[model samples]
Target: MAITAPIATINDHSVRILAWNQIGSWLTYTDANGNSAIKYQFWDGGTDANSGFIWNDAGSGQLAANTTLEINAADLSQVWVRGGAAGGSETMWVRAFDGSDWGSWDSFTLTTIPNSRPVATISDHMVKFDQWTRVSNWLSYSDGDGEAATRYQFWDGGTATTSGYIWNDGGSGQLAANTTLEVAASEINNIWIRGGSAAGSETMWVRAFDGHDWGNWDSFTLTSQPNLAPVATIGDQSMHVGGWARASNWLSYSDPDGDAATQYQFWDGGSAGTSAYIWSDVAGGPQAAGTAITVAANDVSKIWIHGGSATGTDTMYVRAYDGQAWSAWDSFIVTSQNTSPVATIEDHSVHVNQWVRASNWLSSSDPDGDAITQYQFWDGGTAADSGFIWNDAGSGQQAASTAVTVAASDVSKIWLHGGAATGAETMYVRAFDGYTWSAWDSFNFTTVTNTAPVANIADHALHVNEWARVSNWLSSADAEGDTITRYQLWDGGTAGNSGYVWSDVGTGQQPASTVLEVAASDVPQIWFRGGSATGTETMYVRAFDGIDWSSWDSFTLTTTA
Candidate 1:
């Protein structure tokens, strides 16, 4: 084998290859603001040393004909771009030499992310974070190579990290994903960690803290943008707190009080420059002027009483101003009551599933409240008469439909506003278990409060051979003083192995405890919790074998939305 040494050099635009081979290269100058006024030449390899060459080529304002540079007998074999212009460190792939027939163009090479570091500890290695994306909830990413991580850490941006990146090892503790976490939900108050999941994606859970003991980490999961955190806070005149809003949610507050109203505010996470809103003088006028609103980790935006006038029930509209544009009226009339409403505007969320369980109000209240009159949902204009009527409509408040998990998808088009308008305040949250109704859970909020409605169904998932984990936070409360929020899971099987089991990992906080999951075990099927105790949360899942249990591994993936 023979190794050849490379060579190259140039004095002017033309390199004196041997002697007669000296080819003078000149750049063709153009006028209309072109970037090609420079002197580098894209010679086509053939050049004539003839005296009139330069004058002849300049006449056409471009290469007179296919101008080709000639290579002397021993000219450097490698053809390349002659260097000129700014510093020499420009990106190589994007700046190729311009040839007679070829123009310089951008190369297709993608920008490179640093490769994942290798690992020296643990069974499987995990790297890269899938936080707050618009696709899969908490879909993690890491180099699948056996190398151990150089460092490991979880950050929510709420707490600043000196370095945005985490170095593996002694910086953070180590734990198995099985005995570790399940799934996670990013929220405002109770941001859950130790989020986990299992096979069949059925089992799910999260660990949460209210600045107190870790409560049973609830079970939950998102269909989109899992890490998308809560963005707003809601409250009434008495207690101005405990409100929940997702990425693009729009909670409506109607002002029935003939006059306008006022409000309080605070929130986080959004592009402020693009997320601001404007008020219009006319009904449905364009957003005139307003500061750019961003939903950062801690920044806040609120629509207070701009002062409304006019006598008697003049219905002031409370619409949501998404960064892109204003959604339809979020709420209708506020009347005399002062309220800071709350609602979650989901993504591509078309039809809401309202399973009619034993629905109805107990015999009492208004003169017409004998046995609970009728049920009708709304789509802004008028209430839809087409709703499933319950045969055994029980005596309780009907469900008002608020989000269980805020933005599983995106906040773009799905501003959840439509709902039941004329039914009793409370309703049952029922789910169809492929057969009968899985029992109804009651929910209610006062007119003086800004409590948004609750989602009527639990996140149900299935994993073969393992228990169908159902993260049911569908607890309820009745206006009659009986509030029941305990959710039950059941499988129509001969044995009890198919029913829902109540197990918790994270302490349930308002927002943090919003994440959950059903995970797969080492033995084809298993269930356990994932996430963290502190704010640095992760997704993990564990499985239980009849004889023993396998360890938990943090979920590492990059799924397409």
Candidate 2:
């Protein structure tokens, strides 16, 4: 029986294949007679059956009618199926024979699936100076074909892949421009990046390949952080009062970025906001800052604390600044030691047996502004000398060293007596603050010799039987300014003789005894009568002070008839 050409149909119509990949399909043909044998021919390209080769597989010759056969592209040379364009149609010609007649070649086409390009995306990343960071951590990739990347390119600043670097699956090494490398997708995670010597923002480009085509160039910003701030440290320190507390003595600076400190600030208390007092000068009077003081790093020692006024403990805060930013605040203890007071004394002169106030020759001052609360007096330069310190009234006295509190009303009224011995003497004094005593201050005390008084009498001329005033005839003078306390008059040159000494009784002068004594106020009222003999009669008179008596003087009284 004559049979029409078997109708050619493909069993798997939706099957898609890649270039150079193997694909299996089932071929079915229709035959009218059940006993008719079927044969098929398969070829690729050219017109139907004129330009391609015939398939000679075991299943190519079919015996039964309406039978199915399996066809695989792996059986053909790789170049046969690879001739079609990517993601385009590939044609295969097939014809069937029903034992006697062969039908025109029937064509069946299969589509080649194109490979999806791997998409690469990179986000902006932050890098610190001199710090290394992983480049892959900021990169992501996707492939629609579920293929892994086989190659990678990195651009330092631009999207020119030929001028950038490449990495391979074996290891990371420098690759020439316009070069290719075979690298696994997992190996790309080893990529790392580090900021250069300078710190700033820059752009970088990257692309990945999925063994076929490279993805579009993806860019990202790599911002480098600024330099690190300096580190500040301070140690506790101790200083005496009236001394400056310098920052260089305790503060230290360091920086991880290798930068030096440019400026610094200081606070009085433990914290910067603790607006306390800090002085820049040794006087510490008006050059004070209640908040903070900022100065150059070179002048670190110029910054002084406020401990000069008094003695105690103080807390100070300090910080340093690099070219970029300031460091954290650091605190330290400033211990102010106590300072003793200073004593001073002046030389003094006094008369013998005179009492002088010791406090008048003694004075003191303290550098720490502490008050002089007490005083100690000594007879000599040292505290072990024997000297008398008398009370204000000169009633009570203490030998050698003696101390008195400032609270006493007469504390500074200390009395010292100049003894009868006339010469130079030394006295020592010391002042005490609340803390300690000052060094002894010695002073010279000189005593002057006493001089005796001089007695004088002018010669008196009076008529016989006439009473002339003798008050003006007797006068006294002293070199030491001593007052005349007593007077002696004699009729002759002997001190025991008393003549012309009269007493007033009952409104008239009466004859008096050979000797008479009277008060100094009554000396002016003494009246002397002319002696019976008018010739020159020598009368001697003398004056006496409390300490010494003056020499005797003589005067002549003349009577005329």
Backbone Cα, N, C clashes tallied per candidate: 110, 0
Candidate 1 worst ten-residue window by lDDT? 341-350
RMSDs, each prediction?
A: 42.8, 24.4
lDDT of 2 by residue, 116-180 (tens): 78898889876555455565667788889888787777776623332223233346554443344
TM per candidate comes to: 0.14, 0.35
Displacement of residue 245 (Cα, Å) in model 2 is 9.9
Off by over 4 Å in 2: 1-199, 203-224, 227-305, 308-317, 320-352, 359-374, 380-387, 393-395, 405-412, 420-426, 432-436, 443-561
lDDT of 2: 0.61
lDDT of every predicted structure (CA atoms): 0.25, 0.61
Estimate, for each residue in 123-167, the C-alpha lDDT of model 1 and write its tens digit.
Answer: 211211221222122323233332322222222221112111211
TM-score for candidate 2, residues paired by index: 0.35
Question: What's the lDDT for residue 348 in model 1?
Answer: 19
